[model samples]
Target: MTSSAENSGQPVFTIIVLGASGDLAKKKTFPALFGLFLHGHISPKTRIIGYARTKMDRPDFLKRISQHIKNTTAPKVKTMLDQFLDQSTYVSGAYDQDSGFLALEQEIQRVEREAKIYDRLFYMALPPSVFIPVANGLKRNCYTTKGINRLIVEKPFGMDLESSRTLSKALGALYREDEIYRIDHYLGKEMVKNIMILRFSNQIFGSCWNKDHISNVQITFREKIGTEGRGGYFDEFGIMRDVMQNHLLQILTLIGMEAPRSSNAEDIRDAKVNVLRAIPEVIESEVLLGQYGKSEDGTMPSYLDDDTVPKGSKTATFAAAAFHINNPRWEGVPFVLKCGKALDQQKVEIRIQFKDMGNAIFHKDVAARNELVIRVQPQEAVYLKMTQKLPGLGMDTVMSELDLSYASRFTNLTVPDAYENLILDAIVGEQSNFVRTDELDEAWRIFTPVLHKIDRGLVPVEIYPYGSRGPKHLPEFVTRFGFERHAQNYSWPETSQTSVAQAVAALSADSKL
Candidate 1:
């Protein structure tokens, strides 16, 4: 762990972003850094240096980054941007060569020479193929021996279990576990970050978060859009390795893990690792793999139709896995994880279904089963749906929710983007929301068997239409794993729409006056 003296007391450091020309860096990395600067999260002495293979002048580089930067309309934000970009510089570099790294080292040296403390952070926004070479180059040519040095690694860590382990071992040889931050952006989400507080702080939930009260848990990731010209890269990782293994699995561990011993990063991470270790390998029968086909109206193309994706490729764009934990708290509960591209909607959420009521007051219209849902995107919310007595009625029950919707409920505050929160966490040396090496090991161990079977053609990928809900067999798959479909249709109340309508009405009234 990095000491307080090394990480704390008003952080002053230089951020080196590798693969600055890549999509991840342009879309997420720089925007996050700008957000931190806009919010006064970093010291004035802090600097940002961009490293990439594509050579460009300072204005060209700034122009590329400007597309992702926002809030420039505000004079204050414009002033901040002027200052932030002034501290920024760019360098063109080959990932494998020493000359570029030597140049990078010189830049770091120049930044350190001007400051009393020398702290550095290296953000690897590049692909896995170049991870080792870049790490080697950085360590050999640019490691800061003066103060703290942290490396932030982005996913897909590796293709499968064996490869993941190999990559971890190689990276381990260069960087200490504490010095490396394996980022799963989902962990930095507003609702996800609130999970610990919601679980441990409230007895209403903490007391009953177990197999006794919970019947089943579903962690789902669905996207509305298909690969859309990115099938070449998507084919390499697929949905399993891309989303389910790291992103969805991280959420499941949080929901199933026992309370941490302390607020320390290691303690929280240890709890998550324990949860992953308790899970048995996902069985072949308990798995469902699917690929998206053309839309019903023939408006969209199938995964195989993409020229970049090999013809007749069997790579799965969707995967559903049912996992059973061996631990006492979650022994009988099934943790069903599902992720896919080109689905009915784009949503990421955790749904915990409670035990069904057996013969309540009105047997004919039995009350809807209780469900606690933590919506992670589109609009952030934590809501519990329970049966309630209908107002001004005789012994009638209807579903109602005790909801906390971020959009309407927290109108004054904006939720920081996941990358922003994560980048800040990395700068401050917080690992609680990041993936630890052991956690990754356990995660890969749990899914490697199924992945192998699919890769070897032992298992076949099912087909679903683009722009439709995932596999026709998804219902049966969920039911097989004990997820009960409710007879009564239910939907959470739309608070955001109502808030917008009310605001519009108020403006209209003011105009009339």
Candidate 2:
């Protein structure tokens, strides 16, 4: 089924991991590449290069990467790791200068010897400060003219609309939009990727996914751990820029957008952009910001307590805001995006609360509003809470869920890391999961004014216990958007820490087998 010319023309992939000595490279980037290698997605001839300012020998690099790679004990996996490490080489360099880039390019060309075409995939794992400089250097020095050249960038794209547009212009000067992959790794998530399928493929969800059936939608991102040692970085961006602008907003677009013309990248992105453009600017009154205080257990420190944070810093560790889309599908429907650090729990989910039934025969008994919840992490699931008659003979109604828990239902499930999926997508020239330039610009447009207000002291940052469920006003904040919690307490069994670990371990075991 294969021709010799076609086989010979297969691009020789060269992956250069920028900021290779950084935590992201060790914890996520290298691990993801290794995962692809183990799964036979990466070709044997592919050359993996690591570039960073930190000077480290090959052994040290291998050890750092090995900590994140799983199943190294398995015979086949051991061979793969050995080969992967063998293929991996380190390059120490400054981002701005041409000399370093020239040296790096020399190394790449050496490995790519004899190949007529060189496919270069540069993964920018560094911060925004050096993004432009690095791109300039790569374009002038290392970019291949023969084959496909893809640049994969990580986010915190920019602080707001102006900054995002500026970054886009800078990158646009060096590369074509299709050659640049701006990753919002959330789009690579299993359930997040499933949202389109869940909405478009399923007749049940597609029929009622509008303002009439949905009262309000809430997208929440919670983190249990505080900024351990990254307070300096966290303070610079705060929760809104760090999470909401890129991660949460991307998820919101996917959830709120109309069905695409087709599954093509640009078509899906066009649909998302239409919904984003319809959203008016986020208002000051509708926004709630907060900084975390000490934990209730008294063992944890407050956000300001971190040595790196200024003593009187007003940086918000938590933020909750509501956006109203002016389009036909989501008109008047509030989409609340909430995110926080140092919270009581760690989870991300989207909750779509439907309007309450009017004048029901058992109105008093059926006080619970119908809700469709899609859990994004820590045990992925989707459940709809609907009023059901009590199992007993009594004429009473109770709320229950029609649930699909990934762990329980799909015993053979092997959910890939978000980065792994995105990396593979990048290698295969798929842009659907990556962010488009206009999408980033539109996202910043919706929140720029609110961000300015927060920066200008117009929005007061409330204080909540580090280990508590966020600010005391969280309930009031959600209620204002018409999000109703069932009167009775409903505890999700799999939300606990132990259960999450078990599910993850189960998935890991399945992946190895």
Candidate 3:
């Protein structure tokens, strides 16, 4: 594969994965760590210790991750592949007791004894409820006295604001804040990582990146796939808590916050936490919740009708909510975040609409605002569209976009999947790729009122067809806030009216027959 000693300061130790046989580990966590090994990006003696409740041999564990690796291969991954794989070992450790944890501890000790390394990283791939017990057991029985015993845990930190605090208190008792790395893979996305660089490194951008220059921010993380066989989980958490609460809020904080005092983890993380804490208290009028109904052909199952979900489930499959940062820089600018399952297409994008330029006498109809769109998935790119004079006799101006797409612009540039990046961060001892407890609490704070509103029936559950773009009046809701589909007062001629009229006229003709 790659060169093992290429990295200058990798942690000199063994690493462990709790629930190593789980879906996240089998599909994502292992593949990501293996990517680091294949690239020669880790210390030569690093041993990955996989501990799970399931009884499996080392070969079985190794067999589980082969398909995921080939599916996400880097161009330089072919040469040193075996060397990377040689570092991985598997063991069936504790699920809910101390004896199993002792074996896991001994395994880590044996790995260090065999390979002669010290640093230990304990990663939990189990559900959130098991996180506290696993961390406590690891701290009490598993951690070696030699080096760092860092913990990495996955998301949905809590159901709401109150639970988030409770979970944080629980975690704080076992591990120091710095020792706990609450991973949000979205924080590892290439474009999301680039957002800070795009804002601070560019001179022109830094000057106008404020409330005075921007109007509103619209974020959408849409998925075309329905629950499939996951209706049980989808119905319980809903789209709001699943996506908008943590992932979307993190993005908004990145785009809206001021330059951190410095680029260090503490400075950047502090800025994010501060901004998230400032999200104005939510109200009922500013939120919209919805669920997908049965499809027209009656072929697709509705959310409740899915065999896995309980009947008459009230959890929202779709959600649109408004949040405002009380800070002066983003006072009046509405931060609209919406996400859903089984409606529209799979798209994750951030649209920043700049304020319209005031009267420039030379052109009365040329007040079209500029927009900066950051594409986060399927394609990673940054686009800024500005209005300029066209090369024509009429002195007309046309809007043109400046684009920077990762696939097209970067040769030899392979942005690793978020999971891969996060896993690498842990190996390299970088906590910037993770979320802190304060950030988690602030994330829940922004949406807790909205969650309460949905719970108390203050916000109605709007329903729409299974395979459509969310609620029918969704566009109207945004329009009421002095915002529109494109931008304020920038009208485009209609293209859908002819089709609607033709359908109506044809229906009339059919009825007459």
Pairs of residues clashing in candidate 1: none
lDDT of each: 0.88, 0.88, 0.79
Q: Candidate 2, residue 25: CA error in Å?
A: 0.7
Model 3 TM-score, 2 decimals: 0.89
Give the candidate number with the greatest TM-score: 1
TM-score of every model versus the real structure: 0.95, 0.94, 0.89
Instruction: Point out the worst 10-residue segment of candidate 1 by lDDT.
Output: 1-10
Model 1 lDDT vs. the true structure? 0.88
Clashes of 3: 4
What's the lDDT for candidate 2? 0.88
lDDT of 1 by residue, 327-388 (tens): 88988999899999999899999999987777676563467778899999879999998888
Report lDDT (Cα) of residue 441, candidate 3.
Answer: 76
In model 2, which regions exceed 4 Å deviation?
Answer: 1-11, 114-117, 364-367, 495-513
- Error at 434, model 2, angstroms: 0.9
